[model samples]
Target: MSCCAAGAEAALQMDGIQPVSADELRLASRDLGDGTRQTDLSVPGVHCGACIAAVEKTLSALPGVESARVNLSMKRVAVKWRALDETPPDLIGALDAIGYEAHLFSSATDEKDPELSRLIKALAVAGFSAMNIMLLSVSVWSGADAATRHAFHLISAALALPAVAYSGRIFYLSAWSVLRRGRTNMDVPISIGVSLAVGLSLYETYYNAPHAYFDAATSLLFFLLIGRTLDHVMRERARSAVAGLARLSPAGTTIIAEGGERRYVPIAEIQPGAMMLIAAGDRIPVDGVVVQGASELDCSLVTGESAPLRIGVGAKVQAGLMNLTGPLTIEATTRSENSFLAEMVRMMEAAEGGRARYRRLADRAAALYSPVVHTLALLTLIGWMVLTGDWHNSITIAIAVLIITCPCALGLAVPIVQVVAARRLFERGIMVKDGSALERLAEVDTVLFDKTGTLTLGTPRLINTGEIKPEALAIAAGMAAGSRHPMASAIASSTRRSTLEQRSFDAISEHPGLGIEARSGNDLYRLGRASWALDNGGDEADTDAVSISILAKNGRILARFAFEDSIRPGSLAAVNGLRQLGMSLGIISGDRAPSVEAVASALVVDDFRAGLLPADKVAHIAKAGASGGKVLMVGDGLNDAPALASAYVSMAPATAADIGRNAADFVFLKDNLSAVKEAVDIAHRAKVLIRQNFALAIGYNAIAVPVAVFGYVTPLVAAVAMSLSSVIVVANAMRLRSPQAAPAPADTSAVSGVSLRTAAAKP
Candidate 1:
């Protein structure tokens, strides 16, 4: 996405860095010589340099606190001070008072990002003073009187002091640190710039030798800091989604007991076999069976399908899902850890924390540019000094080098692009959970899809019927109503059988890998395979007329009902679209070959593997991935979890099993195969915008830096150019919203009901 926004798309924008007072500068520094304690605090939400100043300024004013340096991009605060007589909670509270939520970072070697705000602020102040100082000196060029000059010099000195103490402090400290380490960073040139200007200005002010370059030092600081803040803000926006997901789950759940009892019970405290009563609109407490009452539950969280499902007695429900209708009582069958919702949350957390194959472009750039910029700054200083014998002129040239090459634009390049592109993606209902998943998606060349819920109407339907009494259909519906089979359950629902006598048939037995059987009166009822019922071998010729054959008490056929899973409406189109995108598509299904092949043909899949266990799916994905092509696995069943994880990037519809959905890097709420195309297209568009932004930023700097170096550009002019460059980048990225130039991904067909949208649709 472009880093700049056009007129209608403008949002909050960043200004150049403005340094605070010496008192503020002191907040960022401390004398570790006093045997003070040190602590590293991490706040994942810190967005800009202003946040840094807010945290530092508040802590610095505290009685025993020494110094605090807050890294805006890293969201880290480094503090050094004598042990607080106050407790850790008090210290945490202190941080909280400044709008910062902090947690103590436990790592002994916590890495700190070099704060860009410091440079941006320094540049802002330096630019402002540079203009004012130039205006004041112009009058002095015409022979001002003693007091006129004294007053002018005094004003100049006053302006220079804050710049030196606040914005310039980091440069000085960095120079000192690098000096000690036998190396130099970009700060080395900055330190030289400020030191020369202020030192020479002080000499002139004290001894009345024309004028000093105090203005130059301050101007340099301001420009650099502005660029820095823009970079930080963009990155914060990019990560907002994952952070928002983290906040969705509550820290604890409220459980009710007898006599209106209530307490804060941690999620982990929930155990299986507990009778949990949930009120309307409350999150389901844990995975459990509906033991009392009935309610409509919103399983959007579990399936990504945006529909509310009705849950009645004997139905299974899970935690994190909201009860949208009436209150219900549940007999918990699994602990919180085993609940589907918990598994989704766990999956998201793992995906967020797991290391992707590639790092982000911005981080990689920062890593390489830091040392290079510092080296280039050093070279600029030496080159300028060689060309100019006068130290004052050389310092001015060196400061210009530092100001122009601050790495602010370079830092803003990647993050700004990602933020715009990601926000656009969120609006389209495709969530890329892993920040790095987009890069992986761009590289995907092979796609593996799960059959049951992925490519076909995972739900079953009554397709045909033969010689079955209405009463017999009602009885079968009532008996199979509570089953979990994809077929029997749906066929059982083709009638209103709720009023059927609740009979406990004798000899009730469910063959684990097969179907159910029972005895009522003198009738031995069989409800699965035709062969199982007739006590004969399964025949392919007869399989063509596949139907459920219910037997009567006297070996007569009570009824024959045909059930078939419909292919999703757009599944064929989606398969075709992926093929157009140069992806190889195939299917792995747990269902038998006949069912799997039938659905695959509808989708026009080239290859199909049937009766796959979860491990088999994983092995297929793994084998495909081993060929060096990124594999995107789309699935919804529990059996597809491993395949989802092993693929380069995975996606699942909201109705997918919790573990499978969690394992996926992306989740499509609407569940049409079209989302895959839409998401990938969006990612590709984002990459283009990012590249455009990179060019705009690099080109602007290419021209602007030379102007600043040659002294042809004033501080005010530089700020305007920098701001305009930023606006352009953001505007470029926001263009993703226009559908005509960037058309929506095409959907190939609507022949079946594969969209999770259909699943979520009310009956």
Candidate 2:
């Protein structure tokens, strides 16, 4: 069966699926019965506020549904209703009552109505016509003969009618909507102004009057359309993360039958309990438990983690994690629909497409401001006629005022900044998940850091060892070699430096929180806790991870390994810069207290936490957030998820785990916390640029609106000045396109896991 068919069956089997909170399941009246009949709805021709309100209001009036909400953002309706024995056809009939078609917006088809495409095309025509009309209007301003001026006036009106009715349809629809709502917004004045300008301009052309301003109205529509289209494009581009999830598995899987024969099959076709074999470096074909062998899996590619994890028999794996070890046979425990990984992918998709709370002050204003400008233009014409007694001159000045104040520059301010900020971040290997992150970053005042994986390198090294040497590590290394864990690999790597001919170690053992042990020769070897090694008695003062002792030919704790991982280059400078800028810093981690304190002390950070779980980290972050300062939390572990979410704006390393990245507001690549500090500084500067741009744009209008209204300025001249002012404001905002950060000081401490090579390169 197709995915659509499968989804339908699941809906049938379960209670019901409601896309939103209240939907086709509840009725307006208490008399409505169980409305569980599957409501398959597909809305083909829905647009404008009326269509949204009409569909929602009508569908909710159906016998079963009590309430309904239409997500105009998605063009989908959700219903609440009673459980019924009927099929979805009953709900379909009810939506038809509203004089519209309603069917499920099926996921199967790639078809989309050309409504937006048509809008763009119309907008382009209006814009092109407006520009040509503007050129002709300029001739009228340059002392042309009355006949020539009149000819251009008629030409301008000829181009404007189609522009207003087609390209500016939203202006009319929105104005009508507000009136129906018994409310008023910015669009009211704009629509009123445009209506008055066009009406009077056409009258002037027909009556052979001298003051038609058709060019002015068309210019306003053109610029507004440009701003609107740019905003739409920005939003569409920001939603690529959703598209990322959609393109995740190739829509298929490999299945093993009950008879144990394997065959490639569609991911949707796999059933629970089917065994499947996955090769090294291949994605697990299904979410399942390892029934056959062991391997190290790198789920981090999808999860945004750099480290690989070991999985053995009884271990569970997801479909996207790449297997890095030997082959493993997995038994499917849940069908693809019920898999945990699948649920994660679905949730991420849903979140990306919904409820981001993306609002810019400019957008909110534009959405309402257009109508207000229209109304003002109408009122202005009436005032001029009443005051001046020259109807032709009064109407021309009103057209100039409308053209000069379309709010296009005002609308473009925030969106342009949003796009530029996102683009700058992308250039520097950062992905800001959504607009809210940037908004919060602009106001952040404090930063909370995760000590282990964020500020300090997550990789631990043997910083300095005492007397234990190569022979002492034989059993330890041999046993660890058999294991696939990170610590095992670390120890094995260190042991490989010894050129000693190795012997097979037997009876290898591991104690989860303690350590591991194995036997290589007659001389016994001990490699674990101080107590465990010292029972046979050896020195135990060293705190190194690879510390050891021996029961050998010459028994001694000889040559303990001295290992060190350095801090990332420029780390100190970044921290110092943030502090100098008056932000407080704190660190939290799940590592041992000594380990946490060691790095914290090196950096001179006053506050730090060790051994915190995900919830504990969140609590700490909430505590910081509630303290009346904007806070930035940074971490790259699963344990950091909640804390990251709770902060004003949190950053994650590119290597962060899936949950970490998901919870974080910003993601930093190159795994340098210094970049976090730099980004914050950039955000502060961008906010400043935004303020300057707004002041400039608003200032231009404040000066020009009155001049245009007083008839000291012609419509053509006003259009030129207004368009120039907007361009200047945009240019001022573009100043934030560059970043400025002092190069960070190199870290010299080898306690952290950063490389010394970068530190040495520092001037």
Candidate 3:
């Protein structure tokens, strides 16, 4: 095998095993530097908020397990414990005891998810059997003689026995696994209902009874399978974001060997201090500093800013960013496993786990559903036996109760709405990461914004280009163009019209953290920091003005170029729309007070905090929450990550740092800030629809449960009613998908002035 292929195989093999001992697990785990060891385990059975809660609770309750968090989006559980006290085998055993089958997690196994295909096959079998058995049942119901009914029932038994046994294994296996561990989930009751229906139908067929319930058992499986299939498909779709991100890093990179020879090597094989060459359009393979060459890198993935950042010698470049303009030689500072991209993945997973702690409305109902359903079924059996003294009839009625109160509608309620709402938001360039984010967003009464990238075009623009003479500008641009720095690029771009082919300098040099200078005809022309270029380190008095860079020829100051972080298009309108919605808007930033206030004034935001650290931002959010304010934080920086997690609901630009985006509940793709407003509006509409769905589910149960208990519903009627309730709930959720119901598109004009070229570079 090729070296890269072998390296890939090694990585997969390391994570592919089911760790048999604590020592084996330690090999796959990381020391978090705080006496805690963390490992990720693939728990494919996690499907809903309840599953998240169950898995976390079960593992967390174990001795030596400090914390166990499950990321529903990834279907992975991250467990942390002291290495001295616990082992991987102990935790795996705990998960198994709680009915969750887990294995060491690896990205290589993501494509091998079998649940969707399994559910689809089960659904098809159940659907085909249900239709065939129903046809047989219709003849028996139409006043057929005893022998005819018996023969039809016999045929249905022959068909449904195998079909239910095969198609119903999805529920049966889960129910049986949990029961063996002496625990119960929603599937346990469902398994009991299916088995009882099939068993009773078989008994009636044996005795040649007048009526049989072959149709009910088969039909129930078909409907339940349909729900499971839809749920699985939606969850699969939700996982695409993380999958897409994982594909951003290059499979291999060209690294300089010990003898200065270049060879293509897998990212896993590159170590710290290794030198790698990256050409234009290649994603960086590791976090490193540029040692040679210069380039404009698309750093949207790291800073959440769509602007391409110019980098040269001494500039740091992170993995996952594209080398947009030129080739670069870099010295790797970290291995691929500990690069910025990998850290982002870890941060996202951790943030998602924290968000998963929010319980959905359906889960709350489910907690009450299982005990209520079992009690009602028990009472029905006892009451029927006491009144009629017929054990067979009583057991039949009790089975009816269990099958009737299957919670099909309750199960469909939130997921259907979430699926619809998520689709709608996706169409609007908004991605909802968690199921409960919409609910939390609907409660946000206050909105907080980060200054630099969140509400403005993060690229600095030369606003004072018109003030300098064309010839002087030409000299400065020529000197600045030699270095791929942000300020240098701004100066070069602003002076593009001042180009003079005849004015070539002899040599250009850049001073680290200072300025650039070029030698022309025995005189030095400089473009850089005002003090460094002018040879005077005096503070400028005009604090509110944009930043200035000095231009000098042979120690004589020629001009100063001013730069500003331009406001994003539609920022004003987005802020206005949020205010019009009665949400209080404010700004919190780590920038200088003057810079923050300048932007805040232009946006008409009066409530603002400047020069705040990450902890300070979190403190502000906590104080707001204490005052009963539901804050919606919108930011796009590593520093904003903590504040994002602290808010009631949070959003980040797609260009945002991986940590920031992962911390946010919602991520908007477009450059427009109007997405923030649209997300909130959709959230409000979704909340209404969700409540309506719950009412429909509850109203159906309130009326149907009593009738089933009173013996007014047969097994067949109960099955039909359950299917109808589910259908009704799903149909109501579909309303969110309507075009007319969508929030009006944000004004495109709001995104003007910031050239598309700078804003279009996706991470």
Candidate 4:
């Protein structure tokens, strides 16, 4: 029967099952801005690419539906549609027509992981039954008499029958559903093979025949269930990165009530303009401005940077940051749902959805596999019947062919490797946001780096402290302490003054983008741009340094405090390592030419561009790609966000700006730049393992399929061969867990204890 006819018949048969209504689906969906509504639904039957194609095609054909994306690893489909014209019931009906059953996905609905637990239980039952059935079959094969052999076969059948019914339902239900809709999947062949083996064995036993396949049918389920369980476990591990991020925000926050009393309230109850108390060692619950107190925040979750940022009054603190020092009183600037952390989670989900569009190796093979396997099996059966005129023998060989060519190894080939590689990267403080990141990372031939936050520590430090007198430095620091600009902060930190010295300066006022000014007795002091402080009359110092802030009193220069962003530790080693791997390196920076040159020269990078905007950085990446280069862009600022998303592959530090981290494919923790090299090396090795897995899967089918077609292999032997092939593929993938260190650089002198300073000096 055609799929449409079968689907209509199945719909008739499903009279007892209640269909989900439009109102119900609407309630489940969340508005995704711009008139789009999206909802995630659990799709249990989606095992391979064919399922993905079918589900997407069916739902996307609905009116007002914009897109339907399936994360096969998660067994969840995210559908987006125009809210004004479409409803959830419409999409659900389309899925039903296509043989898939979906329900609104809720993580809190189940306490334990229901899917994993089910797989484990089914595997246990299959394993136990297979062992007992095989033992009985061993007795029957030991040359027992007719009556004794029949008794042994009956005993084996009793154990195998229930086991198959219970454990094999996972495949049988999926196959039946698809077949009822007039389509086929990997489960179709699997269900057919298992049913035939068990049915034929039951008939042969009842008729007192010489052979029965009770052991073969049960053993196939045992091994196949093992593969299914492992696949589930790997997917769960891959999903932990997002889950870990979600756990960083507290569910409730301590709010400072109107009467000065503190009360704990759920995150939802905390609104914009609400004041909250964030104590040390607690995660900030909302995006807010610090109204009181001082502390350092561990902002790695937001920026991907390892260093803690010092926050004082008026400083903005985002949700998901851990307060590391004193308590802070903050007024919430945004609701919990719209906080920066929530935005990061949304970006990650969207990026992962995009990544899922990349077809897996297994799925690509399956698209070509289903038709060929069915045709070959059918041809083998017909050929045998024509040659020998024996229907029974022909059907037996055909069943063996189908059973042996089950795609078990092919289905497992890519996902297993990805899971293993992700786990290894996770251990090294790197989180891979998508499965395709490793593949894309492996192909990158050029590395593009941003100067600030990417190569440098991103924190400016005073470089000309020795050039100023102690009294001048103290006055500058006191004035600098009144402002929060990067240069001012550097000067303030470099010059520590006693409370008495700070008290000497009064009436300090900050000039935004220029500098800070203060009055001490009769002298008016200013520390900022030379033009602003000295009115351009001061003698100009000729230098190539990128940033220079001047300090003056009464229009006379006192001292010039030059600031430079220090290079991160291991940057030279990382650059050298990439060079050793034959990767072309370059830098694109918004900083002035001198500072950019200083960093590029320090790392021995020759290709460099300075003073580029975000769009220009993107154009630079595009130009490299146009020249046949696969670029890996590493950056950590709001300006770098666009370029990060545009690159072939991207990495960001944990301390990167929210948008930059969101756009990046991988986020590495730690202050050392060596993580970049480590990520690349791991990706290369992972690709190697993925290729080996493909080879093993294909090679197994090459040798085993012919033997089954020739009728030289029984169902029992075919089952063993199929199981062995999947095991081999998984074993090869496990090799990715071993350490894959980048080659050490030949020279460590520049990388070790090197201080980077701009060439220009201020007089």
Which candidate number has the best TM-score?
4
Candidate lDDT (C-alpha), each: 0.59, 0.59, 0.74, 0.77
What's every prediction's RMSD, in angstroms?
10.8, 9.6, 7.2, 4.7
Q: What tens-digit string does per-residue lDDT give for candidate 4 at 622-642?
A: 999999999999999999999
**Per-residue lDDT of model 2, residues 650-708, tens digit only:** 88876677678778877765655567767776678767777776787678778888787
TM-score against native, each model: 0.71, 0.66, 0.80, 0.87
Model 2 reaches what TM-score against the true structure?
Answer: 0.66
Residue 283 lDDT (model 4): 95
Kindly indicate the candidate among 2 and 3 with the higher lDDT.
3
lDDT of 3 by residue, 368-473 (tens): 6668889999999999999999987887788778877866677556655665666577666676766577878888899999987888767767777778777877
Model 3 clash pairs are: 304-655, 304-656, 569-750, 569-751, 570-750
Return whichever of 1 and 4 wins on lDDT.
4
Residue 15 displacement (Å), model 3: 20
Model 2, clash count?
Answer: 69
Ten contiguous residues with the weakest lDDT in model 3: 1-10
CA lDDT of 430 in candidate 2? 61
Give the Å error, residue 454, model 1: 0.4
RMSD of 4: 4.7
